[model samples]
Target: MSVEGKAKEAAGYVKEELYEHGKPPESQKKAQEGRDLRNEGRVEDGKPPKTTKPGTSH
Candidate 1:
């Protein structure tokens, strides 16, 4: 199967697994918050916040 097809199948499997073995609401909320934070540049590569030197730009 193509990469997209495989990804879709994997997503379905994960959804079903989470439904069956879901975490507690608070933990799930915290997890989702972390996801949002990462999306908003709170963390990088599972590490702490990134730092940049003054007068430097990327």
Candidate 2:
């Protein structure tokens, strides 16, 4: 297999390991939570969640 193929397979294995034994990283979890809240039209402390345009740095 090519190097790229091996890297992809390794990444899949790591994902499966994490799914079986560990939580996803906190930052990713938080980001998904924020997205879910936004989709639900939730406001925290009277302020809507801040959003950023894709491909733009904060």
Candidate 3:
């Protein structure tokens, strides 16, 4: 993943860690944005976007 995408994902993780009682919607949104950016980068490199797992949503 690109550096900005990685940083966003890491920030989301840290937010989740700091608010363990309940996950905030903003954190989830940030992580999803990271995933989207990573997929966009992959497509720019002529690769398919990463597939989500069978039981997961992305």
Candidate 4:
């Protein structure tokens, strides 16, 4: 393959890896939203939000 083709192939691999295993964990924004819903007793399932640790998967 040409240099450009090889570079594109490598980039494709990187994109696939990132898609399969997402980037590093961030804040619990989604969990917080769930908590807010729980606090308001508006949760769909009437369940509290699941807690998440920093740098850990939800």
Candidate 5:
């Protein structure tokens, strides 16, 4: 699965629990929007932050 997929899947679980408390975590919205943007190949406006983190050498 893509990063967004993983994020959304995790968010879904949190969202379910949050609803009982009448609150939504920002992660839920961010995850959903990220999924949409990634699907369209326009992540962060095609300009992701520069990073030297391992596993991210593109």
Candidate 6:
């Protein structure tokens, strides 16, 4: 994944960990943004997007 994407993912992960009892909407949004960015980067690199089970981390 691209550095930016990885960074966003890490931020999201931190947020999730910090709020383990309940994930804020922003956290989920950040995570989705990270995944989308990573997928875009993969496409630009001429590779397929990585797949994961729904509701699971990449």
Best by lDDT: 6
**Per-residue lDDT of model 6, residues 1-58, tens digit only:** 4666555445544554454444787766655665565566566556677677435665
Backbone clash total for model 2 is 0
User: Could you tell me the C-alpha RMSD of candidate 4 in Å?
Assistant: 16.7
For residues 1-58, what per-residue lDDT tens digits would candidate 2 score against the true structure? 2454444444543443344333558645554444444423323224343365422554
Which candidate order results from sorting by lDDT in descending order?
6, 3, 2, 5, 1, 4
Q: What is candidate 6's CA lDDT for residue 15?
A: 53
Model 3 Cα shift for residue 4 (angstroms): 11
In model 1, which runs have C-alpha deviations exceeding 4 angstroms?
21-58
Selected candidate, larger TM-score, 2 vs 5? 2
**Per-prediction TM-score:** 0.33, 0.34, 0.53, 0.34, 0.31, 0.53
- Specify the poorest-scoring 10-residue window by lDDT in model 6: 13-22
Q: What is the C-alpha lDDT of each candidate?
A: 0.41, 0.43, 0.55, 0.39, 0.42, 0.57
Q: What would the per-residue lDDT of candidate 5 be over residues 1-58, giving only the tens digit for each residue?
A: 3565445445543443444333456645654444443334323234342233222445
Candidate 5 Cα errors over 4 Å, as ranges:
21-58
Once superposed on the true structure, which residue ranges of model 4 sit more than 4 Å away at CA?
Answer: 22-58
| Candidate 1: residue pairs that collide | none
Error of 4 at 52 (Å): 34
Which digits, one per residue and each the tens of the lDDT, describe model 3 over residues 1-58?
A: 4666555445544553444333777756655665565566566555587667422545
Displacement of residue 46 (Cα, Å) in model 4 is 56
In order, what is each prediction's RMSD in angstroms?
12.7, 16.0, 5.7, 16.7, 11.9, 4.8
Please list all clashing residue pairs in model 6, or write none if there are none.
none
